[model samples]
Target: MRRFNLKLYLIFILVLLVRISNAHQETIRVGFIESPPLIYNKDEKLVGALVDYLNDILPNFNIKFVKTPLSRVPDLLDKDVIQIFPMYFYSAERADKVHYIPTSFHALNPCLCALKENKIPSTIRDPKSFEQKTIVHLRGTLKNRDFLNFKNTNYLELPTQDYYEKSLKMLKLKRAEYAYFADFQQVKRFLNNKKHSNIHCENSHYPKDEMFFVTNKNFYLKKNLELKISKTSFKTYLKKHLSRVNWQVD
Candidate 1:
């Protein structure tokens, strides 16, 4: 009986050590972009709604965040250089490379901004009405697919400089009659500038798209995240975070 008791005690100690080692294992690296109020760097620290949400909910999870240019996220995910990415919408090409969490983390409302000096209509009610009207947008992006179908609208695609302010500046400069498509919050932030007061953003016409998290297919936390997010508090936290952007959770 004494020998049997000794073996059990050793087995228990070994199991406890193994569990502790696993618990303290290397932190998972999460990649994000500077889509503020969603995720962005401020004062050299990662700060934003998503950052706050993760901080609040994942106390037990070991996570290390990495901020990079939003443009590079796709390639980085493909190479599995980053284990996880947050707040991205589903695309067929992305789907091919990464596995998405089953639930949408939040939604975004993309809007169009036009300069008041140009007498551009406040809203784009009819696609056909865009004929001959010049629309400026960030180069390498074609987010407004429905509006693009009306090829009659002249496009002045501009290169991005890690921000959308330049695209709005072009509209202010009258380089284009209107600038089309950005997250409503981004447009609001741009127009808040005194110089951009001449710009009017049309929130009436926009697309409401759901955003999700993507991870390398082999990421260990992929399954665990699905479980964590299903909790009531997780969704409540998400709703609270998005509320800052005037987004409602259904």
Candidate 2:
């Protein structure tokens, strides 16, 4: 009788443990900023290359995406509002706020774009070349430190709503002489629109930079998430997804 009772007690504990584990895996909140082809809303559904990749790789976890502006991402992560940010460029400043998965999923090449009629130089070997030039970019995406090399250059920052296209339009309208973009591939994709045909981007002079998945510092599953991301062929998946949207992966 005592043996039967002990067996039932053990079974109950096992069931409870399993329930707890399942609960923990049920939902993981992921934060995203609206960057087309990477992450965006379409037809009332969250869909994009980064979204598809995360959904495919994390089949076991129920993901809830929280869309926020780029500037608020660090605060959201620090406050534990989200467990993961599926795609982000690495910076020492960001690293202090969140932990990055050691493996990089993609590479980006930064470039300067301007209307062909503007006749900006094709390559920028020296920052002085842009002296007194007016540049536009998405606010919070680029900083004065990024342009520490270029003194006296005018910077016009715009909000993130359709930023890529808007930045190009600003150049076409002569509001800015150049548009600085962090990802050459993203700029290339946007340039496919006939309206932007006159815009030409300078060849990237900087070495390719890698982007990684980042998690809140306090996230409990950071190690497991890192191992999963490191083991997956994320680059291949990203390339395939981007290609579907006519965006090249580099």
Candidate 3:
């Protein structure tokens, strides 16, 4: 009886040791860009809706954040360097690389943006009317890809710019006749310039599409753990900032 009791005590101590070892482990890492209001970097610190959300809900989990270009979110997630990024459109090529989180939005309402001076057709209502307008677009963005293959348009397509807002400014400044934009909040921020630049969203625009997170197929194999973190963290993010006016698209 004494021998049996000693064995049980050893097993309990071993179990406790394992648990402690796991507890000391570091948290999973994540990445994002400096898109203001959505994701922003201030004084070398990252703060925004996404960051704030993680701060509130991911405390229980171990996480490290890496700041990078928005263009890299899908690659990082695929590499498993970070856990999530917000406000991205779904594509077949991306689908081949990672699993996407189901969300309310896929693509944003994109429109034809033009300098106040461009002569837009009264008949212009869709992509078809962009026949002769010199346009600025971004690489890897839906707008760029959608317009690149155009055999119909007679105008020139400008090189992809670093920022979408900057591209719009380029269009307004006569660098191009038009530049299309999708993210409303970002667009609003760009247009708020006191210069009161003459740019307008066409009365006829494309329908809004879906945007959501793509799981890094390579990095995240623990579905249960990721799902747990994703659910709570995203909810906390929305709960805290969703009510703020800055988040609205209209």
Clashes of each: 0, 0, 9
Best by lDDT: 2
lDDT of 2 at 113: 88
Each model's lDDT: 0.67, 0.75, 0.58
Estimate, for each residue in 1-250, the C-alpha lDDT of model 2 and write its tens digit: 9999999999999999988887887788898877767776666777777887887778888889997666777788888788788767778888888788888877778788888877665455456767888889777766424563576778898877767767877887888998888788777876784446777887546556677888877788888877777777766665665655533222
Task: Report lDDT (Cα) of residue 185, candidate 1.
Answer: 68
Clashing residue pairs for model 3: 27-62, 27-63, 105-210, 105-211, 106-209, 106-210, 106-211, 107-209, 107-210
**C-alpha-based local distance difference test score of model 2:** 0.75
Minimum summed lDDT over a 10-residue window in model 3 is located at 241-250
Indicate which candidate wins on TM-score.
2
**lDDT tens digits by residue: candidate 1, 1-250:** 9999999999999999989987886676788655655665555666567777776556666778876445667677768677778767767776877889888777777667777766555445576668888888755445535667676888777654444666666776777777765577656754564356677777655667677788878777787787766552444654554445422111
lDDT of 3 by residue, 138-211 (tens): 44455434554556664443333345556766775686776656555456545664344677656243556565
Off by over 4 Å in 1: 1-25, 69-71, 118-127, 138-144, 154-162, 193-195, 232-250
What is the TM-score of each predicted model, taking all chains together? 0.71, 0.80, 0.66
